[model samples]
Target: MGTESSVKAQAETQIAAVTSLSTPQEGQKNRSSGNFSVENLPAGTYALKFVVEGANSGTHFNVMKDVSGGTDPTIWSHVYSGNTTDVQTDRSFYIANPSGTNSNFTVKVYALH
Candidate 1:
């Protein structure tokens, strides 16, 4: 494969590792919030990205540790008004999943340091 193709292949794999569908399991209920663990990751710096299936038309989404008055910390909070594709990185922010429940969108982690 060409260099571009090879790089794309690797990226696809890494993306798979970090992507999580919000759809609930067999009999579970759809949650008002979702969580994605970017764990085992060095406690350094990261860029967390979210892609809401076919959303972005003035939709509401948040990525944090608590949605209901929990004292957990938050890193990415916004009311997006555009598609969160690569070109529009303002949709991207820095925040780990904080290891438990309390996420609201598809999150991808990129380590930068």
Candidate 2:
């Protein structure tokens, strides 16, 4: 029984750690034009949120497709524009593993007025 309890406790601790680590720090920004990776990502669906700084008013914001590892990333389910500027916009994608292997990916956000 003690062994079982220990295993359960360890599992709970691991779950907590993963939940805390999976979430990117709020207000984090990536300004470079290269492949950015999310390490130890839980295998499931996730939304990639971007906060566009310096976006001009009246321009449409597009979450461009991913262009890394020769795989094309799809656009978000919704489009952002105009008054939705300078905020965290989210787009969903799926991951199948949590290994260190980087699912190398890139995305470009553009203005389309």
Deviation of model 1 at 10, angstroms:
12
**lDDT, candidate 1, 25-113, per-residue tens:** 34523223334444343343333334443333444444444334545444455524232322112222233322223333444444332
Question: TM-scores of the models, in the given order?
Answer: 0.35, 0.25
Q: What are the candidates' C-alpha RMSDs?
A: 10.6, 16.4
Whose lDDT is greatest here? 1
TM-score of 2: 0.25
- The per-model lDDT (C-alpha) reads 0.35, 0.27
Off by over 4 Å in 1: 1-31, 40-46, 66-70, 79-113
Cα deviation in Å at residue 41, candidate 2?
6.1
Cα deviation of 61 in candidate 2 (Å)?
4.0
Can you list the residue pairs that collide in candidate 2? none
